[model samples]
Target: MRVFAVAEIKFGELDPVSIELLNLANSIKGDGTAEAVVIGNGISKYAEELAKYADRVWKIEDSSLENYNPELYVDVLSQLFSKEKPDIVLVANSSRGSEFAPALATKLNAPVITDIVGLDTSNGIKATRYIFQGKLLVDILVKDGDTSVFTVRQGVFKEGSEVGGEVVDAGIKPSVTPKREFSQIIEPEVGEVDISQADIIVSVGRGIEDASNIELAEELADALGGVVAGSRPVIDSGWLPKDRQVGISGKTVKPKLYLALGISGAFQHIMGMKDSELIIAVNKDPEAPIFGVAQYGIVGDIFEIVPALVDKLREIKG
Candidate 1:
């Protein structure tokens, strides 16, 4: 088997999920070859970094790829894969990766799976993904296909150790005329903290009652030496900034400790923080969906429990 993992770049740096994809590819390659494919302009450093983990790195550094264009990406990858004919192609389930995986699959006449959380190749190739809004996991076998493409979910797989490999220059230039033009990248304004990188996050939801109650969560987060985040409801209600939002439509985080205060555990919200190392949910409703995935559950009102928790933490610290 020959596996190829695509690298994703964000703000001129290699996205962390790219490494996760490489790790997954290496794990399943067994006696076969595991390679990485990177497309960008002047991304030699990224390619070099990937070479440490993959058996080989196919670096396609072209001026035309300075900015991401779905059409151009599909065209370039399709041309390459048509000739390479890799047995499996792995892409991150990120915004850009999801956009191009299906197009590339169509070009290669291969089956495409999105948001895959697990894979097994012992018998044939089986991929596991969530169905019914993440309420259930369904395994689908890739039958009757020589090539398969999968967009892997982030934070599902463990990072693997690096094995030195060689970096090969693909030297493919763009030939497709894209209907869309590249524009300047628009980045959201950064707040006092970047929740995605936080070690501990105390998140709020509609159960927070009002904007003023957000201060309670913030105090608890401060006491625990963490940061404050929120679900879409809290962000939409202006209780927190857009950068603090955690959900499917917001930022995905994998903090060491995630304290979901008053979050009802909607599928969208769970998608963002389900990968946390330790999840502790506090809600008055014992049957809230958040408890389904939480490691620790506290069925109580946040308005009353948060103040006590903050006081306890401060006492422990002092």
Candidate 2:
């Protein structure tokens, strides 16, 4: 058994999703070698960093492949796989991974799986992913061929912590021209605090209603010595900046304590913060999916409940 894990990098740093993929590959490799494939300009150092976890690292560096042109990436990787085929390939379930994996699988004529939360390696490769807003877990198996491609969800598995593994320079350059050219990357304005770094996060959802009501949640967060965050709905309504949003498309936060106010739990949102140590959800709907993973649930109006809780906390602190 041999595993080939693709690594993703952003802003000159390797994304944690890549490390998680290595960890998953290690878990599933029963006495098999786990190798890593990293692509991009100036990614040789990252290959060395990944050497700790992977048995060997395949560094694919090209001037044109610097900024992620999907066509070029697919063409280049397909050429590499033709010469060195592995039993299993793992990719991160990120924007680049989602876009690249399906096309690569098509080129390789292999089966593809996305957003896998669990893996059952006992009987072939059984992957588990959620359906219906995280309410159900569906397990899928690949029976088509010896090679299978997977796009793993972020923050689901812990990153591998080993170092000093060997590095294999793949040194293959395909003569492929892309129809699309690389462009500049636009960055969002930096906020006072990054929610991903916050230990205690108080996140609001549609239940907050009016934009003015956000202050109530903010006050509660202040009293708790934490920061304010929101679900996609709150950010979509412009009550909070995009940086304060927590979800799959947003930021993934594994805070020490997470307080959800007025947000119904969707799988996309849950995927970001499900690894949080303690989750407290407040919603009027008792059947809200947020309550399922929450350690504590409050079924009530956020308007009435948040202020009361804030006042009580202030009094206790006084």
**Which candidate gets the maximum lDDT versus the true structure?**
1
Candidates' lDDT values, in order? 0.88, 0.84
lDDT of 1 at 11: 80
Tens-digit lDDT string for candidate 1 (228-314): 999988898888988788876677788899999989999888988999999999999999999999999999988889999988888
lDDT of 2 by residue, 1-318 (tens): 688889888767787677878888888888887889988888878998889888889888888778878898888788878888888899888778899899999988899998787776778889988777656779998784868998887666664557457887788775788788877986555546767667899999999888999899889999998999988888889999887888866777878899999999988888778889999999999999999999999999988899899989989999
User: On a 0 to 100 scale, what is the lDDT of residue 74 in model 1?
Assistant: 92
Estimated TM-score for each candidate: 0.84, 0.79
How many clashes show up in model 1? Answer: 0
